[model samples]
Target chain A: MTTTAVDILGADDVSRAITRISHEIVERNPALDSVVIVGMQTGGTWIAKRLCESVNKIVEGANVPLGAIDISLYRDDYSLRPVVLSAPTDIPVDLTGRTVVLVDDVLFTGRTVRAALEALNDYGRPRAVQLAVMVDRGHRELPIRPDYVGKNIPTHFSDEVAVGPNGVTVSAVAT
Target chain B: MKHLLDTHDLSIDDIVNILDVADRMAEVNRRQVPKVPALKGKTIATVFFEDSTRTRLSFETAARRLSADVLTFLASSSSVNKGESLRDTIETLSAMGVQAFVVRHKSSGVPLQLSQWTDASVINAGDGWHQHPTQGLLDAYTITREFGTPTSLAGRTVAIVGDIKHSRVARSNIDLFTRLGARVVLVAPPSLLPSHVETWPVDVRSTMDDVIDNVDVVYLLRMQLERMQSASIPNLAEYTRLYALTPERAAVLQDHALLMHPGPMNRGVEITVDPADVAGSRILQQVTNGVSIRMAVLFTLLGGDSVSSLTAGGEA
Candidate 1:
């Protein structure tokens, strides 16, 4: 099988996606004070920072609490994959009675989001939990959907999608 | 990677990784609800052949916080009193689908021996005077936290004081501290020193006065009354005079120097000053860090996909 790499989204597209998602978040949730943004560790950390920055610009004086969670402990695939821990989970405030906006880099198997949901319960019960991702590549093993999506790029199961500050690239099998 | 038998099996990278995970576990422990579903379906059986207060409770608490089911097997209450063989007892627990075993025995290498009889991951809580790897890791973690960096102990010097011959804490820390690039100086009487001390990687000092002010950390070891079959020291008063962390010696310590004790401390024998009064004492922190370090060990052994691939029959 021959693999071909193609740039699915450019750097400008990535920036615009954040701006659009930030607007969508502000439009859907009127009470910005009750909203908190949490990024998944490693991959989602940078995107979450950017999302928080974009949301802050959309509404002046919107100080969203940015946090990060490492779901290595809460994963369902410890038996299937090597479970390596990442950065520490830092939830700055009591998450009870607050709407949590969970941000991630990519949405594929949805297993990581499942683990993230379980991890959130340990902090405090949130009023509502919403997921935001940079890329939704369409192979979800769980019944999880991203509320705010950057780009819905449908691809094969074997194809790989890499998200970065530069752009989103997909490596697919050549026809 | 599979079982935590001793510090010898842990490389500097493995030690650093465990400490890093321990930092995360520390975060979880600080939460309002200090629990995670990491090991919900998994069970950890703490099979202690000897008596304990903190080590057993610490391991159990670590497992419980991680949402792992804990089965406590006390040697006194169990069928072992009815002459059940070690193999039979282990087989019994292994039949119950235990994924991990935290074994503490009065004899050295019992956990290593037990790992052979079962496929479960074995953690050596304390085995005679051989090693206590988690304690080593926790002590290292405590120092790392004090210094404000994970690899900050690289240039620092640590002095291990009292009962070097029969102290598993000293044995383990000597390996762990030196591996993390800290110079360890062992302070004890000639009789209390191990027989083959020359082969070990450390500096030897006879009294605390020799290296009192120069060290970065002073780690006190408990004088195990039970382990002392023969009188290694002349008397408690003489031992205290010669080696105990008295007020004068404590005053001689640098302001930046930290005091650490693996607890249930022998106040008059090893540490004479009140730990509470000392500004640099980390005794209580050692107890607190033990939970996080054990959680790291338990999660590393049971929650990973690597252990399932490795044959448990090989040496740990």
Candidate 2:
């Protein structure tokens, strides 16, 4: 069963969005000495590393600590499916009192952000946590909202977004 | 993440999911380019404050297979000799961009504490005697692979014989086996049985011979001399005579019944039956499964998905 793919954001658009987000982050928190970019696993993680690179280029002497977090074990549905052996969560920097920018590809239900928060809490409490997403498809089930949104894409509950190193595409199927 | 905190964080389905992923990882182990670019630019810091070679090496192999660099920190050469706390070492490593932290500490909740202090993933290797989630998962996988179904443990009686009080393996096995539908019998001397055994969902037996003929599997646990602070038993020999799985006693079991052990076996102390001739011995299988199981765990926790799925009402 094949489905049609709709171009939501291209690679150039993503790079521009990330560049703008980096500026916004520095503007929002002028005292930010070092930024720790934690990707929300899978695609979000790749985006986070790229965003960190962009942010480093913009700010002098500002090197962002990067890490990838997996929240599979913390999922509420953990009991529903078989146990999934997850990859190693790699956060190569200390999170103690540092400004944490959680990056993701798409923010749909806000649950991923919530899980990232829970997973981050286990690591350490950050000075402040800012959420950065390439696409913020609004359908929040919780009170949580992103601190810096790249592009707010509105859609029905059934639609989904697939983001990779190539670009961001939207689909009707639930991914 | 470095530390494997607790088995309580894992559900029955979580255990099964990891086992399934491990099956796939096993295939990866056979390939020529066994290494994947999954954790290419990453590093896994394994800090074992306790004594363990099998679990440590298994974790190392799993990380290496994923192409993640490994930095092993044993207590011997570490600043731990200078009384540097685990927290200090973790913070130092965190500064160096150590991505994931696999920690095995003697304290029950040390991994959880470290998890709270670092940004890295905390994979509890084995904490105190509280839980060995990976060991439990691998054992479950071994059983499933042998039986041809994940839930084949159902209706089977698994008798866990030996140091139940001090064995993290036994504790994890009880949870996993029971979840897989096996009726678990924890056979050990009263002194070796934890006071909290009554709280667990398992039948307790003081004698191994009583349950020998009925069980489908005999699981022996090691008896650490460190645990016997004041000689809980009359002597090691007497203890072996009373509770060990002797060759003659093993012969009483059904021919199809298996024998298993989470090794670093204590030979004559825990089991009088030689490990070499134990017909159903899957101890080696458990070790082999450890790498694959760990690979599945690392990939699932870090690889293909978002952290969102872990939360309530997370994005699909």
Candidate 3:
């Protein structure tokens, strides 16, 4: 039997999920003056940009500043992991007194988020830090959960939840 | 993937990979904490058989920033003075569980020899006048930082002026610059030029004025006064007249051209004070880049984050 990938969220579904997330974020951060958003590098940065646009559209001219971070070096299992390729990590402003919302593409093991939190500590101590993810596939090894999630996909151990600009896909591992 | 003994071992892809990592490591320097745990639990040993100010300090600083344990061994004051051979000294350190060795020696090929004697990865800081791979890399990083990309140097001119025969920096830069597709012009007195320069892959010339106006970067090499008198170049005063980077020659450079020097500079001899301090000069920047490039090298060689462990074959 041939193995194939299946789309979990189509373009319209992805758009609706983002719109819902934007509304939730605006409602939680009403003043919109203290809240700042940052995207984890690679896939998360794209989603963060879209999320920023969606958030701005709701609170006209909020123009929330978005930053991107690559957490390659901050992971707890650094010696065990493979050589991590790095990207730009830019935080335009100090995170000290700001309410920070971290955006990521997928949340499975919760390890990446753990590393992101630790990495953020090097930058500054935030007033409050919240996590927003596009896809949450349940396999968390840590006591961590997303504060705001786009879609939750519960899948098998070997399955992959891939999120991109096109949408989201769930593919079984090729045996 | 084992040891970095020379630039000749590095392909264009390898060089780019290292520089990209260096770019990432540069961010750590700007961070409030200015450190990373990427190389934690690994041990690095620096063996300096020759005297150095920037190199030994830079390597140690890079290792500490990565959170790796650093052990520095100075051969002059260490076991090498008491009847121990180079092999014995390295083997003793290897027994202590060192994962990497950064060696600087007055004799050529010492790093290469150490690689054969130990399983640990060897980084050639400088081995006599043979090669200094990382200096070449930092210079490349400096260029890429200035021009926006290493490949942008394809048609750019880089003229290295001063004593050539005794400079490991010149040899490394020549090998690296030509590999990255830059036209390199070697300007030195006929007495100071290496005898075997005929086979080298750069334009061998005797005067700086002929090539000064056209080059994008002018890198001045430190004159080896120790090698003068015995070699063709007899003294510093005569050598200064033909090749010193003075205010007059620095003025002749194009507006966008950069000035560089591999330091421990013999000021007023090879380069005038003001010329070395010019706004276009990237001398100080190169020193900063040195620490980052070294961190990149250490991380790539020892930062055990395997691609297989995190990517395609990573088991959940």
Checking candidate 3 for backbone clashes, the offending pairs are A81-B305, A81-B306, A82-B305, A82-B306, A83-B305, A83-B306
lDDT of 1 by residue, B249-277 (tens): 99989999999999889988888899887
Q: Per-prediction TM-score, please?
A: 0.95, 0.63, 0.95
- Model number with the top DockQ: 3
User: How displaced is residue B156 in candidate 2, in Å?
Assistant: 1.4
Candidate 1 Cα deviation (angstroms), residue A88: 2.2
Candidate 2 residue B275 C-alpha distance from true site, Å = 2.2
Estimate the overall C-alpha local distance difference test score of candidate 1: 0.89
Which of 1 and 3 is the better model by DockQ?
Answer: 3
Q: Flag regions of model 2 displaced more than 4 Å.
A: A1-175, B1-4, B305-316
Q: What DockQ results do all the predictions give, each relative to the true complex?
A: 0.46, 0.04, 0.52
Chain A TM-scores of each predicted structure, in the order given, are 0.96, 0.89, 0.94
Give me candidate 3's TM-score against the actual structure. 0.95
Better of 1 and 2 by lDDT: 1
**Count: clashes, candidate 2:** 40
Residue B280, candidate 1: alpha-carbon lDDT: 89
